[model samples]
Target chain A: MPYRYLEDIATADVAFEAWGKDLGELFAEAADATTNVMVEGLASIKRKETIDIELRNPELDILLYNFLNELVYLKDARRLLLRAYDITVEKEWPDFRLKAKVSGEAIDHARHRLKADVKAVTLHRLSVRETPEGWKATVVLDI
Target chain B: MRAQLAVPESIKKISDTVWEIPASYKPGMLVPARIYATEKLLKEMDAGVFDQVTNVACLPGIVNYALCMPDGHWGYGFPIGGVAAFDAERGVISPGGIGFDINCGMRLVLTNLTYEEVKPRLHELVDSLFYRIPTGVGSTGFIKLSFSEFEELVEQGSRWCLKKGLAWPEDLELTEERGCFAGADASKVSRKAVERGFDQVGTLGSGNHYCEIQVARPENIFDGNTARAFGFTVPDQVAVMFHCGSRGFGHQVATDYLQVFLDVMERKYGIKTLDRELACAPFNSPEGQAYFAAMKCAVNMAFANRQVILHRIREVFSNVFKKSPEALGMSMAYDVTHNTAKLEDHTINGRRTRLLVHRKGSTRAFGPGMEGIPERYRETGQPVIIGGSMETGSYLMAGLSTGAGAFYSTAHGSGRTMSRHQAKRTYRGEKLKRDMEARGIYVRSDTWGGLAEEAGAAYKNIDEVVEATELAGLSKRVVRLLPIGNIKG
Candidate 1:
């Protein structure tokens, strides 16, 4: 697992920590963790559609939030059950940009077992820090 | 000076129902932090509630104490069950104060049918409801609106539902603000927010959101006059209650503003908050006003959302019992919003002033004399719908005169005692379903994992929370609602 659900948080929402050898992988893992929160068995999600997401923020943390929030928007707006397949993060000083390619299809209630509808990505105690291992981000999804 | 963000330990017991953390406990705090909970509840209260409430007290121009209701639980920025008011001229408005599910509220409907009358066919009724009322994640309503129509819905609130012939005229009368709040500017709402919300107006969003068919317990009615006022005339009278809000529309609006406020709050407005999630701008500033206008659109959208759901439910009942809506005597009891910010006049420090009151996971229990309540309920007071877990039961309550102490607010529900992950680990969803079935409660949910996360053990005892609210004179019980059928989203 590239990300792990954290139990230290409160009951009102879900918390998880994503890790990677770099920012790109960290973001990809984070996206997967978010999608996993809503439904399990990502392997069963046939790639009926591909969605391209791009986000720009001067700060890495805010950019991360926008990225995740964008996923939530796509899920609700297009009714897609998504799983991030690939991500690339480019950051230089005050600029952070991310482009992610995710694959999924319209939600089939008969197929996909919906777990929790993530309302949004909350910045409450949102954390994105660097360590020797590469990059780690702690986030919460307001479900 | 560095800000203190830790759980305060300097709290002083004010009464059995009140505790105060003085402003002196935190250097930047403009006011104290007061919690309306029993000693027992406080003993087990999450430390995050104390920290968040104190953070709220430190906000600029906060009036009096930042209060947390009896159901207070740890949440982002503002604790769930938190209530605070900011000055129009000086204070700021935080999106976090209302949370992402804007206008997340509850509305109860009363039916002439009694428990005994519906018991034999309860299975059929539940099945029909499950089939008729759209629920679960990705669920959509039958009614689809064009962009122009969507804009109209946002601007008109519940009135739009009535105009579309989806809601009864009596429904608006029993709603907060008569089902319409002023200052709704759909133009101010972002296109993305509007787009996201357009299709989700009637969906029951997931995570603790549900529509329940409950039977009124005759013995649970504490006030006959109030119970009669609410249309709960006899024991076992059935009621329909639902909890939801503006889906992705509200989320997008809140997300858009939180980013907007973050970029310019300190540099442009000189506003400072303890948490980034508490990002806010002065209430009078352009950014704040824009957010307020957009927030109003979200509020109206949520009201319309529930109104449409009520229409669908009425349709289902009509088909099942073979009675017209009027003949069934299906009337709304009252609709109450748990998350919102409204500018209202309140006497603060002797003078009456307009303050923007923000309540998150809290219910407004306006006393009998308040102007905001409906005429039929004017003498009894506002209906405070306290939703309980499907395993336990829910409550219908009425405001009391003395409830002004907590700014006319009470607990929203039995707050979470265990985390979702913990609950899932502790109980099996299938087992829970079987257990509830054995008790005659029919629960239909999309996923067993979802059901596991919302098991009864995950929440604090509803009875305790209601007892605290009543003992503190925040609200009095009208009747307890035992869930006969529940549709979990």
Candidate 2:
């Protein structure tokens, strides 16, 4: 796993740190960590529906923030449990644009072993920075 | 990673139950931060409470002090049980202080039946409730509405339920603000928020949200007169209590405004906050007024959500008992909001002034003789519901006149001590279920993992927290409720 849940960062909510060789990989890992909080088994979510999400922000951290919150929005608005893949991030002038395809089926009580329902992605201690190895992002989700 | 913070050396013991971090301790602080906790609770508090509460003091136009109730814990921008009042004209309004779950609150319903009357059918009642009320991830409510209808419903709040015959007239009177928050302009709400919340009117969102059947035993009545006034007249009188909020609609509203505030707070308003989550705009700014109007829509949506759930609860109970809801004498005790920012009148510098109060994870416990409370409860005070962990029990409290110190606010629930990950690792859901069943509490949950995360041991002792609130003169205990049946979302 490229992301790990942080124990002391939050007591009433979930916090995790995700890293990647680059921004694209880091965004995917962070998305996975968020979905994993709600569903015990991500692999159990069948790719019956695909959602194409494109978001842009001048700030890399805000770009990731909007990306994750989009997934949470889909969970409620579309009733889909998704896993993001085929992700790409590119910097266009002063803006960072993120485009990804998220695939999953409508929530099935039989197939989906659900856990906590994440309310939203928060900006609490939210950060994205490049390290020696690659890129890392810290996120705290309000559950 | 940030190092763990220790108790600040600048903190002083204000009283046996109150601790203060002087404004001089931190630059830019306009007022001190006061914490209402017993010595033990204060000692055990996570360092974030100290850091966040003090940061709140730095907000411009803050009145008196930044306050945290006994259940205060680590939260994003403000501590979970944080409370602060800002000047109506000069102060700022931040989504961080109000929380994402806009009017996330608690509601108590009284039934004439006793525990003995409902004991044999406890399992059936809980199972029926669980099946009727959607739970867990991606669950939608039974009420489906077009986007336009949703807009109107939110503007109307619980009044929509009354018009639709889903709520009793008396229920509205018992709810705070009569179930509808004024100044809710749906046009101020974003389309994304409307889409996310349109279909979730009656859902019980997961993670610490639950519908419970509890009994108020004769022995646990702390204040008999107040309990009687609040409708706890019989020995082991059964009641229904549930905790939930506005769901996704509220989250989207907060998210949208946070971004809007982030863009203008410093650039346009020149307001700097210690945390990014504390993004705010002046209350009089266009952005702030727009967000406040939108926030009230979410608040009304939450009230409608709980009202619809109560309708379903009545249906399930009446069906099981083969009696009409009216025949069963089911009536609402009260509904209280935990996360909200409201404009109200308060005393500042020994004069009555209008202040905008922000209470995140804290309930407004307006004492007796307060103007806004229902006339029936004028003498006894507003009913305050403090939900405990399922395995232990909850409490029904009443506000006190002495609550003026904290602007008539108190703790909302048994604050979590253990992290969700730690709780899951420490407790097994199956074993917990069995143990609770042995103790005569029947529980139905969507998933075992979620159940494990809510183990009673994960939270502080509810009894102790309530005692601290009482000692701090925030609220007075009325009756302790023992759970017999629960539906966990």
lDDT of 1 by residue, B397-440 (tens): 99988987787889999988888898989989899989999998
Question: What TM-score is obtained for chain B in each of the predicted models?
Answer: 0.97, 0.99
| lDDT over C-alpha atoms for residue A66 of model 1 | 89
| Lowest lDDT block of 10, candidate 1 chain B | B1-10
Worst 10 residues of 2 chain A by lDDT: A105-114
TM-score, per-candidate, Cα-based: 0.97, 0.99
Query: Which one wins on TM-score?
Result: 2
Q: Give the candidate number with the greatest DockQ.
A: 2
lDDT of 2 at B110: 91
Q: Name the regions of candidate 1 deviating beyond 4 angstroms.
A: B1-7
Candidate 2 per-residue lDDT over residues B373-443, each given as its tens digit: 99999999899999999999999999999999899999999999998899989998899899999999999
The second chain of candidate 2 has a TM-score of 0.99
Candidate 1 residue B451 Cα shift, in angstroms, is: 1.1
